[model samples]
Target: MKINIPETDQERIVIVGGGFGGLTLARKLAKSNYQIVLIDRNNFHQFQPLFYQVAMAGLEPSSILFPLRKTFHRYDNVYIRVAEVTGIKLAEKRLETSLGICNFDHLIIATGADTNFFGNQQIADKAIPMKSVSEALFLRNTILNDYEIALSTTDFDDRQGYIDIVIVGGGPTGVEVAGALAEMRKNVLPKDYPELDCSEIDIYLVQSSPQLLKGMSEAASEKALEFLTELGVKVILNNRVVSYDGEFVEMKDGSRIQSRKVIWAAGITGSLIPGLPEGSVTYGNRLKVNRYNEVEGVDNVYALGDIAYMEEEEYPQGHPQVAQVAIQQAKQLADNFKKRAAGKEMKEFSYRDLGSMATIGRRLAVVDLPNWKFQGTFAWFVWLFVHLFAILGSRNKLVVFINWVWNYLFYDQSLRLIIRTGAPWKKMDDVIDEGERG
Candidate 1:
């Protein structure tokens, strides 16, 4: 089926995925002469960095999401489609998606990444991943439901299982989650569930690496560990999860932790579509791209964000899979497209390291810059300010700021209402099936 895009003499630039990278590219190309078609599985662009905040009830899901249509309403050159790309037919210069096949002159794959289970299907099925708004809300519902179940259960051991939270992979997500849970245990749980013994609720953060926040400096890692420990979270490093059977997680050292809730933040791999050469994928299932973000061996086909592995002299292994890299690459690609349209030589892509920061909890965060390193309350303030400014919509920023201030003053999460009607997986499957049937 032919897509209902506007008939234009300008070249059609198709971008798959509306995450940080795709949205940035689209916005940058808004003023250009190229006709742009942006497709994504979801209608909203999720601010993934604050997903834990939503799960922890610190922020609402709406605060971390911006409607795709709303974002591009003022741009006449761009069109938006809410559909999942199924495959890419390189020979035909077409993409097969949920809506239908659409031809494009240039294709940009910004499909981003998904939670990595590291080849463990059992863990993948059972563990909760925080990658999207729906997933975060589902986690929030499950956490509340588990607490309710804990309160209802007469057996002490069963209650412990319900209340205990185990977060695997002490990266930013895991650390933030553990810290949030610790805060809940210390401040919120006591007030909310007064009958339940908050002390019995355990929060454990398991890291396979030697230290938490391995991407950051040693000082940052050390500070993060200290912050988590001070919040009453147990940090277990140099250990890997061997298996999880829904009730307990077994470690490689023949140890085990009993918990019903397991949040997996261990790793991520590119979420790729079919029809690309199978061998083109590298480590982490990322598509290997050239200096100009063009897919290797496929002209007019490019990739960016977590899905693209562009090796450079400074980053021989490929750049870090962060939102900043994706945004920068997208902007660069947009500029290149404009330059090519004007019959100018295209510029090579180079990432600018703008530093990294991770917040542990209220008044606790770490920031790493080229010449500066800091931690604690000031870092936390910087983290908040940067994130607030980074969010797409003004309404989102205001809502998030209000929520953060409310959470700080009251020590309570107002949006902790369990809205799940049935089993989470069953509901998700039903939705997918409905879409297929439609």
Candidate 2:
């Protein structure tokens, strides 16, 4: 059966994944003469930068996700569907989705990336990854459930194990999560669970590299380390996590950290679609695209966001899988489409380096802008403003800003209620496995 999109004489552009790239492109081409069909597993566009906050209970999930249909409300030519693209029929210009078949004159793959377990099935099966709203909610539930279990357990070691958290990777996500957990250990936990020894709640950040924030400025990295360290996070540098078994995290250096929760912020691999040319799949499972973001060896099939691997003279490898890169590429692609319709020359895409930022705790952050790098209070505010301003909807912005202020003033988060259907104190796979068996 075919998806029930209305038949239009104008060319149809099927965009798989309503992420940063796909959503941006659809909005950019709203006034164009083409019919746009946007598809995603979820109905909303998730603001990824705040996913760690959601996992750490610093922000609610709704504060970060905006409905795709709501976003394209006035755009009559745009259609939104909540469907997973299963396969691509390049010759037929059609997509096999969970709902039905979808035919398109042009296709844009912005499926983004998934957690990279690095070929370790054990780690992949056990470790929790904070990539989307549901995952973040799962992590939050797991953490809170662990503490509740800790309160009932008499054994000191087991209780410590229950509350302890080992976060792999010292990238922005890891650092932010560790910092938030440390803040909770200091402020919220003590007040909420007065009986438990909150001091025993350890937050470990393990990184394989010598420094955190590897791509950012050295000064920013140093400041981040300082901030996290001051927040009482045990930052382990130059060490790699080999495996996790939902009980203990084994490191490469023959050491093990006992923890009930393991957050996998180590890496991400592109979400590759089946039926694409095997040669087109490159390192990190990304699709090889040219300067114009067109997938090589495929006509009318393009890639954007984390899925596209484009190499330039300056960047021997692909450009960093950042939102700016995706947004810029989408803008360029949108312009190129218009240029094609206007019979004008299409321009090539070139990435302009806009620096990076990471916040460790309240009033502690590091920002590396193109011209300047800063840290501490100023950088923290800058980080807040940038992220707040970048959020999609005005209502979302206001809600998030109010939440931030409330958190800052109260030294507590309001959205800590563990709301789940059932399956208390269970890992992600265990829940899935139980469902499958039942």
TM-score of each: 0.96, 0.96
lDDT (Cα, 0-100) at 82 in candidate 1: 90
Tell me model 1's lDDT, rounded to 2 decimals: 0.89
Highest TM-score against the true fold, candidate:
2
Tens-digit per-residue lDDT, 108-155, candidate 1: 999999999989999988888888888888788778878887898999
- Per-residue alpha-carbon lDDT of candidate 2 for residues 281-351, written as tens digits (9 for 90 to 100): 99999999999999989899999989999999988899999999999999999999999989999999999
Cα displacement (Å) at residue 73, model 1: 1.5
lDDT of 2 at 329: 95
Residue 262 C-alpha lDDT in model 2? 86
Cα lDDT, model 1, residue 326: 98
Candidate 1 lands at a TM-score of 0.96
The TM-score between candidate 2 and the true structure equals 0.96
lDDT of each candidate versus the true structure: 0.89, 0.90
